[model samples]
Target: MSKTIRMLNKDDYPQYEAMETGIEFDYIAHIFDRLATGDNHLYGLFLDGRLVSVGGYSIYAGSYAMLGRLRSDLRFKGNGFSTEVVSYILNEVFKLNGIRWVGANTQEHNTSAQRVLEKVGLNPYITLHGALTKDTAALESGAEPWQPVTSLQRKKDWLNQAYIRTGDIFPYECYYPFPASAELFQDEAIKQWSFYENDDKTRFVITKYDQKKYHYLHAVYPWHDLTSQPGLWETIASDYRKLLQQTDDETYIWMDLTKEEAQTLPASHQFELPSPWILYGKEN
Candidate 1:
């Protein structure tokens, strides 16, 4: 008998939950449930009356929608189930015509999910800051405790190194949306960093963003500069200035500061919400 693809409605969630991991189940139940009853759409694949796969997204104020809670049962693996779900959502979302981008996030370890994303032709444009769970301070909204590290008093080198290996002292969601190899950051131009030594520990990490070339300026932690105590953040800034002086053109620089850092070295530069974001579509 052939497997049947079903238009999974909110009522079909229980069967869907059984086929997914706990996190996957809860995510679908909460997030997608809201979207389904509202303006969003949901779709699923059923084999022998069991829900094997599910996906969907919803649009908010923005022209595009976010793709989330996408999953298929492990037994259903290698069946192009994920590609099917993603394709279904894209087909629906693209029909609107004004949509620009579809955003989605998965754990760095979930290689399967990553392939599904690429197979569906969704571009990977973000290196989301990770969640700080261990050996770090919890961030209260509007609170930036990272000023000390940013200021670089004593342990700047050690912390910088840690950021590359473990992550920031704060925490971030690590990602490699494709099959990665022994060498990471193959395309990054700004691979090297040199640190500045100062008594104040008041330092700034000034990285230039090429609006023309939109890629992340990734930080390599354990800050392995050739010098035992080289100045990196400041050095990068100086280099950045040199490039600007040559080009005689200004570029955008986004600062991801801890609450303390923000309080201490808050940029005089004005900023606004980068962009309003949203998502929508049908899941296979």
Candidate 2:
């Protein structure tokens, strides 16, 4: 299918965003407004008069760039449109030098997307099982519960001390991969992190994302992994049950032992989707 692909001018943004928002069934107008005004770059593919595909880079300067909003109209999925969009986006990204790596993920069952990445020369790095959560169960695998917690209820179950109001870098120094991280995301459903120093600190965020399956790790740790040296799986499992008892809400953490580090997780620690989506990229 022949199409004209180009970077959107300021006037084209509203239409581009409209197409995206409609697909998401979401309205983060506030966050989208900031992107429209900021240093990000957006590219669109027009099939005649309609913007049929869209993608962009969220550059965070010296750190990393997040690959985001790579959406194509549902009506165009099987026509091999994504193959062209991914290549065009990479061509533009190669023009910049500071972007260390670009990363993205979809439901594990979305094999079509995996094929697209392979077709475009991007290789799989890691399948982070349970690394995602959603409002409605989007996971094709996992036994994560669907109960959303109330603000008051969260206060009672959460540790007594105040958690820092900032998002800390993940343990491996990975950031949100995009500026949208600045956007406050989803219902009262949020992940709050704090160091629990007390020996009595017992809880686990070891759950997974699955609308209809049990992809959760069935473990929890607050002060354990961060405070002490890496604790063995057996010892951690003992505290995980106590941690699990602390909350009435549903939660899950990453599973699967594809990497040497991940292999340390207990074999008994099961998941609904074990196929890993490797995260890897080259610096631009």
Candidate 3:
């Protein structure tokens, strides 16, 4: 049997939604919304007249387009379908005049997905720590919770502290280099919180919640600031527990930390080992 690749439409959503993938439905919806608004281009692969896989790319600043939401049905496993779909997308990306580079990121534990990416010529480049707080005991420890940093001055102070302590070498935001401007503090997507010591902003944490599947806290910079501070992680853990308690849904909280930062987390906190999420890219 042969496979056919074509642009995906709203009609294909139900079929793609029914298929198993690491991407959550909310994100899937976000992708379709972008597609509808001309913010992204999505493509689907059909086998025997059924949509078995879907993928897409979105143009970003600096002549870059990110490949996202590449997923396939479980029944199609071992057929090299994923690699075929990715290769097709990469070819399409290169055809665009303004796109200079194409890239994607995958969890380190997802070896199967990584294999597909590798087969399509994307390689791993960096490791990021993903930590979760779910253990009942850890959450119930009664430590102090982080308060939201509402004032711009306080937010600026926290960022300045991070910059000074870390020397601005690490990527503060996912794969993109940390912004040199203070405007990062104003992003609506992220909410900033802090654990202060004696009215001084000793520690800070930034997080984004979808109010659905999960809440992701950005990777903390100068993690040593928090780890070295006595009982700070516990305080953060307590706050996390309180957040979980208030939510009736099963939304999980994830914190991205460096390998060293992850290791410093209290053993009571349940989390995955620090692993590298490779950013694979190709120049056009």
The list of candidate 3 runs beyond 4 A from truth reads 1-4, 13-41, 47-52, 57-66, 73-80, 91-102, 119-121, 134-203, 212-226, 234-246, 270-284
Task: Write the number of the candidate with greater TM-score, choosing between 1 and 2.
Answer: 2
Which predicted model would earn the best lDDT? 3
Tens digits of lDDT, candidate 1, 204-259: 33233333222333222222221222344434334445554555444333333322
lDDT scores for all predictions?
A: 0.46, 0.46, 0.61
All candidates: TM-score: 0.45, 0.49, 0.60
TM-score of 2: 0.49
RMSD of 1: 15.6
Candidate 1 segments whose C-alpha is farther than 4 A from its true place: 4-6, 20-25, 30-32, 130-284
RMSD of 2: 11.2
lDDT by residue (tens digit), candidate 3, 135-222: 5354333455445567666666766677634434234444433323343344442334442332355566554333324444333445
Return whichever of 2 and 3 wins on TM-score. Answer: 3
Tens-place lDDT per residue, model 2, 1-284, is 55887776567756665564244453323345545446666677888778877766665434455555567777666777777887787777766665545555544577777777677676554444433221212211232222223354453344222222333222221213221222222223234321122233343332222221333332223232322232223333333354457645664443233344345434443434445544534444
